[model samples]
Target: MKKLLLFVIVFSVLSAATVTFWAHQPIIGMEEKPIEFSIKAGSGVRSSVEQIASAGVPVNPTLLGFLARLSGKSGRLKAGNYELKPGTTPLALIDQLARGEFAQEALVIIEGWTFRQMRQAVASHPALKHDTAALSDQELLAKINPQYGKPEGLFFPDTYLFAKGASDLQVYKQAHSLLQKRLNEAWGRRDPSLPYKSSYEALIMASIVEKETGQKSERNMIAAVFINRLKRGMLLQTDPTVIYGMGDAFKGNIRKRDLETDTPYNTYTRAGLPPTPIALPGAESLEAALNPAKTDALYFVSRGNGTSVFSSNLNDHNRAVNKYQR
Candidate 1:
């Protein structure tokens, strides 16, 4: 009886060792490129193993199953798309699955993009489970947050990561939350003399500043120009606001007639900031709006490049327009 028991123990040990070695071997004929394999959610170990094998990986399902059961990993497999590359072993793949490491997908929201553009981006991502595509703008805003009457510039502009099958609402919620956090932090650190009545007003100004200049160094200066105009109760006379107010009616260019047209968002005609933000503002623009440079400059004009020329009086600004814009 003792001899028979010893034989059984030796055979079991050898069997486990052989299985471990088999699991560690690199799959043959796998090319030097990565291949994507998907395990459906709620898939069992057997089904998952079969799916991996179907992806041209030479894995022994039965032995893998036995090893998984023995190692107490039979029921711990996570389901998602995984990239199987050359030199990847069955053991490594199994370990990855057990740790629930699903592939992440990235979606980027560009700064200065309108909410309409942001919506288009979210609706176009293939990996996301979209729930807002069919909804109208108002309905979508209601779904995201009821307090928000419109969806123009509410979401923060940045790259967001999500697991496969994540809903569009989930992405929007994260962006909205991050925007709120950033806005609050910036508002708390703002210069006390800023003319903004609330954080929302600062966000509106930030959006204008974001759209007005592409140069990072000019942001504070541009903010200061707008601040000076606001303090003097003068017209902002910004062309971007006039373009925004025109909406789809705005052609490729702005004309004198367009600037003279009265609209709530037409800063050339209207007195104060627009009703809401015209585009998404980045962190730097937000900071610049809250902490404008101390300057007497009340106007700025693009120098036909990525930079702007600021002037303290109208004469210099008109001459700059003729020198650069002309």
Candidate 2:
């Protein structure tokens, strides 16, 4: 009986030593890269460890789960995506999971899209929690900011990265806050001689410039044209604002009658800037609107490809229009 007791003691010591060695062994992989792992919400510690074992981590589920419970970390498991690196050990996995370290997901907002398009992109993102899916534009605008009644041109265009499964509201707030910061900074440093009465008017001009920049190199020139026209008491006559006013009636093409139609956004029929921005403007367009190129150009027409020809007089503008538009 004494010999049997000694055998059991020796066997238990060897088992503990084996477990301790396994806990520190690094999980190497092909090309020594990291492996992706996920733990869904409500997953218990046992199931989570089983998932890790199945993710090619070279682990024993029962042993890892036992270790997790033994180390008093079973109740601290979090749900989200994880990047298990090349040197991650079985013990480190438990600690990493308990800390809720999640992989980031990205959403890219294009520069010239309207608020409606931006909302659609946010609502359809798989990684977002879809908390704002049912909210209308006006309703969502209220939640984002109450002072701004209209939603157009309020968001900055850029790639936003966030942890997996983050709420959609989090993204909106981040973008909104960043845009305000940039706009305020840009407004504070704007040129003193510009025609804008307020930063919002500059933003409105920036949106027009964003849409009209068929050739990125011509952004400053386009701003110069509008600025000259605004200064000379001439009609802006920009087609993009006219198209924006048409709304659903604009079938991808603008007719002469469409130009004649009266709307708050129709630059050809109305005077001064539009009531609000037509699209989200990027940094270049915003800068151009605030400080245009040093030129007398007051007219431009598209040259068929993505560029335009600028002219300072009506006769030259008409000649260029006949050369290009005809």
Candidate 3:
């Protein structure tokens, strides 16, 4: 019985000593990572473990196997983009994955963005990559392949979450899908008296509404002004559409010449809705377009602030424009 007790003590001491040695060996592959190196999504522990061992850090894979078995672990690894600090042990890293500790990237899509703007935002991200800007607008439009016209007015204005190595196309597709669903839902519930002939027309007006006003309270009222003009068969005369027609060369401001330009998108010349949406519209703009406030307003001008003053006739509109813009 005494010999048995002595054997147990020696075995326990050896086990503790072994654990201590491994614990102090400097966690594998963590030697050079003082600056927090990221483990991109889809990377596995094997590569990281190898990197650690090559950095002169000893790894006890047998011990890992033992602990894994004891914990009933069935290769439970967290699937996400991870960033780890220097001197992190393989055991510690595995524990993090097991607990599903991963990083989330915030992606914000603002209102009034063209599809190109949305594409550029995703392409320029540091953790993701895409040849979005390299592709022409036509080519990017083809990638999304909306049932409607081009991808304009087809991205939701909201924040999205992307993990490491997420594709730009993936995020764009998500926003596009959401936009389509929301627009379709709103179109189905449109007021029968709204001047829109179809969902497409509603989308066009919504895009104009998105560009025309940023004030939440003014959207429906501004929409009413445009709807009244449409019903009267007068030209939309939206300046933002003309700016969109100018495309890449449209510096920061619009000139008198740009307004008179004979482009399909120049509502000042075209006398009706633009050939396509000038920008992506959000849910508020879509709702406002579908169910505009009932008003006799046939014209509107920027209030020089973030809002627009609505008018019922050309004379009143010109007067408001002179008062505010001039």
Model number with the top lDDT? 2
Cα distance off (Å), candidate 2, residue 175: 1.6
lDDT for model 3: 0.75
**Alpha-carbon RMSD of each model:** 2.3, 4.2, 4.9
Per-residue lDDT of model 2, residues 1-326, tens digit only:
99999999999999889888988888674468777778888999888988877877677889889778877999999988887888878788888888887777899999999988999999899988998888888888899998887989989999999987789988988888877888888888888888889988999999999999988889989999999899988999999999999888989889999999999999988999999999999888998898889999999999999999999998999999999999
Better of 1 and 3 by TM-score: 1
Regions more than 4 Å wrong, model 1: 1-3, 26-31, 55-57
Quantify all predictions' global Cα lDDT against the true fold: 0.88, 0.89, 0.75
lDDT ranking, high to low: 2, 1, 3
**What is the per-residue lDDT of model 1 for residues 157-199, given as tens digits with 9 covering 90 to 100?**
9999987788899999899889989999999999999888889
Model 3 vs. true fold: TM:
0.76
**Count: clashes, candidate 3:** 2
Candidate 1 lDDT score relative to the true structure: 0.88
Q: What is the TM-score of each candidate against the true structure?
A: 0.90, 0.81, 0.76
TM-score of 1: 0.90
Error of 3 at 257 (Å): 3.4
